[model samples]
Target: MKNTLKISAITFIFSIGVLAQEIVDETLNTQVDANIPGVVAQKEIDNLDDQAKKLYYEFKDTVSEYEGLKRYDDQLEKIVFSQEDEIRDIIRQIDSLDNVNKEILPFLKETVDSLRKFVNLDMPFLKESRIARIDDLDSIILQSNVTTAEKFRKVFEAYQLEAALVIPLKHTRIYRA
Candidate 1:
C-alpha cells in the first residue's frame, strides 16, 4: 500500500507539469497570431519612408538643374549685349567710310591734272609717252567701275616714275656713241 501511494503521487505531479506546458504553448501561439497585422504595418511604413526619401532627393536635383540653367541664361544675355555694341560700332565705321569715299575722288582727279601740267612744262625727253600716260590716267579717273583707292594708287605711281626719271638724269650724263 505504501508503494502504491508513492506511485500515485508521482503520476499526479507529471500530469500537472504536462498541462502547464500545454497552456504556455497555447498562449504563445495566440499572441503571435494577434501581432501579424502590426508586423505588416511596420513593413509598409518602412517602404513609404524609403519612397519619400527618394522623391526628396529627386526634388533637390531638379532645383540644382534649375539654378544651372539660370546661370547659362545670364551668360547668354551678356553675350547678346556685347554683340549689340559691336554691331553699332561696325555701323558707324561703315558710315565714315562712305564719307571718305565721297571726298577722295575729287582730290585724286585734281592731283592727276596737276601732274599733266608739270609734265608739259618739263623736259622734252619721252614727252609724247608721258603725255599719253597722262591721258590714260584721265580716262582711268573718269571710269565709273574703278574704285577711288585704285585711282589714287595709279596717280601716285605716275609721280614716282617722274621722280625716278629726274633723279637719274641729274646723277649721270649721256654722250653720243
Candidate 2:
C-alpha cells in the first residue's frame, strides 16, 4: 500500500508538469501569431523610410544642379546683353540654355513631389517615435547632411515601440479575451 501511494503521488506530479508545459506552449504559439501583424507593420515602416531617404537624396541633387544652372543663367544673361558682334551666338546659347532648363524643370518638379510625399509618410513615424519616448528624435530628423541609416534607425525604433505596445494588446484581445 505504501508503494502504491508513492507511485500515485509521483504520477500526479508528472501529469501536472505535463499539463503546465502544454499550457505554456499554447501561450507561446499565440504570442507568436499575435506578433506577426506588428512585424509586418514594422517592415512597411522601414520601406517607407527607405523611400523617403531616396527622395531626400534626389531632391538634394536636384537643388544643387538648379543652383549651378541659375549661376550659369546669370552669366549668360550678362553676355547676351553686353555684345552685338556675337548676337546670333548669344541667341543660340540662350536657346540651348532654355532647352536644358526645360528638360530639368520636369525632373526637378518630380523630385519635389517625391520629397513632399516622403515628408508626409515620415510624419507618422516621427509622431509615433515621440510617443514612444525615443531620445534623439531631433537629431534623427532628415537633415540634408545626415546619413540615411541614422534616419532609418530612428524610424525603425518608432515602429518597434508601436509594435511592443500593440502586440500584447492584440494577443490578449484576440486570443485570451
Candidate 3:
C-alpha cells in the first residue's frame, strides 16, 4: 500500500508539470499572434506619414508657382495702363496742333522723349526692332523743317504702330495666385 501511494504521488506531480508546460506554450502563441497585428499597424502608419509629407511639399510648390504668375500679371497690367495713358496724351497733343506753331515742335520732341523713356523702363520686352523703328521716325520728325501738321501726322503713325504691338500683350491671360 505504501509503495502504491508513493507511485500515485509521483504520477500526480508529473501530470501537473505537463499541464503547466502546455498552458505556458499556449500563452506564448497568443502573445506572438497579438504582436503581429501591432507590427503591421505600425508599418501602415509610417507609410501614411510618408505620403502626407509628400503631398504637403507638392502643395507648397504649386502655391509658389501661382504666386510667381500673379506677380508677372500685375507687372503686365501696369505696363498696359501706362502705355495707354501715354498714347492718349500723344493723340490729344496731335489733335490740338496748329500748322505754324514752332513752339509745338519742341513740345513734340519732349513727348517723344518721354514715351521712349517710359517704354525702355517699363516695357523692356516690347520688340526692340519695333521700338527702334518708332525712334527713327521720331528723330526724323524732330529734325525736319516741316509744319506742325506734318510732324503730328508722322508721330501719330508711330504711336499707332506702337499701340498695335502693345494691345495683344495686354489681353493675354495672367495666371492666378
Candidate 4:
C-alpha cells in the first residue's frame, strides 16, 4: 500500500510538470509570433542606420572641404589686401618723382652693372648681343629725354629677352674656318 501511494504521487507530479511545460511552450510560441514583425522591422531600422552613418561620413567630408575652402579664401583675401596696400604705397612713391628717382636710379645702375658682368662671365655664344643690350639700357637709363617709365620698361624688356632667349652653342672650329 505504501509503494502504491508513492508511485501515485510520482505519477501526479510528473503529469503536473508536463502540463506546466506545455503551457509555457504555448506562451513562448505566441510571444515569438508577436515579435516576428518587429524582427522584420528591425532589419529596416538597421538599414536606415547604415544609410545615416554613410550620410554622416559624407557630411563630415563636405564640412572639411568647406573649411579648407574658407581657409583658402581667407588667405587669398589677405594676399589681395596686402597687395592693395603695396600698390597704394607705390602710387604714393610715384607721386614723389624725385624720391622715386633717388631710390630707383642706384638700383638701375647696379642692375645694369651686374647684367654687364653676367654677360661677360656667361657663355660666349651671344656675348656681343647681350652686351649691346646692356649698353643700350645704360644709355637710356641716364638720358633726360627718355621718360623714367620708358627707361625702366626698356631695361625690363632687355632683362626679359635675356632670360627668355635660348642661346646656341658657339661653333669654334667651324666658325674659325
Best by lDDT: 1
Q: What value does the lDDT take at residue 28 in candidate 3?
A: 99
lDDT of every predicted structure (CA atoms): 0.90, 0.67, 0.79, 0.86
lDDT of 1 by residue, 56-154 (tens): 999999999999999999999999999999999999998998898788888878888898998988878899999898999999999989887888899
Off by over 4 Å in 4: 1-95, 166-177
Q: What are the runs in model 2 whose C-alpha is more than 4 Å off? A: 84-177
- RMSD score of candidate 2 (Å): 46.4
Give the higher-TM-score candidate: 1 or 3. 1
Q: What is the lDDT of residue 43 in candidate 3?
A: 99
Worst 10 residues of 4 by lDDT: 166-175
1 or 2, which is superior by TM-score? 1
Question: Model 3: residues >4 Å from true position, as ranges?
Answer: 1-4, 86-177
Evaluated at residue 159, the lDDT of candidate 2 is 52
Q: Per-residue lDDT for 96 in model 3?
A: 60
Runs with alpha carbons beyond 4 Å of true place in candidate 1: 1-44, 127-147, 172-177
Lowest summed lDDT window (length 10), candidate 1: 167-176
Each prediction's TM-score against the native?
A: 0.63, 0.44, 0.45, 0.40
| lDDT tens per residue, model 3, 67-176 | 99999999999999999999999888866654335677777788677768757765566558756866776777756476667777877776787777678878977687
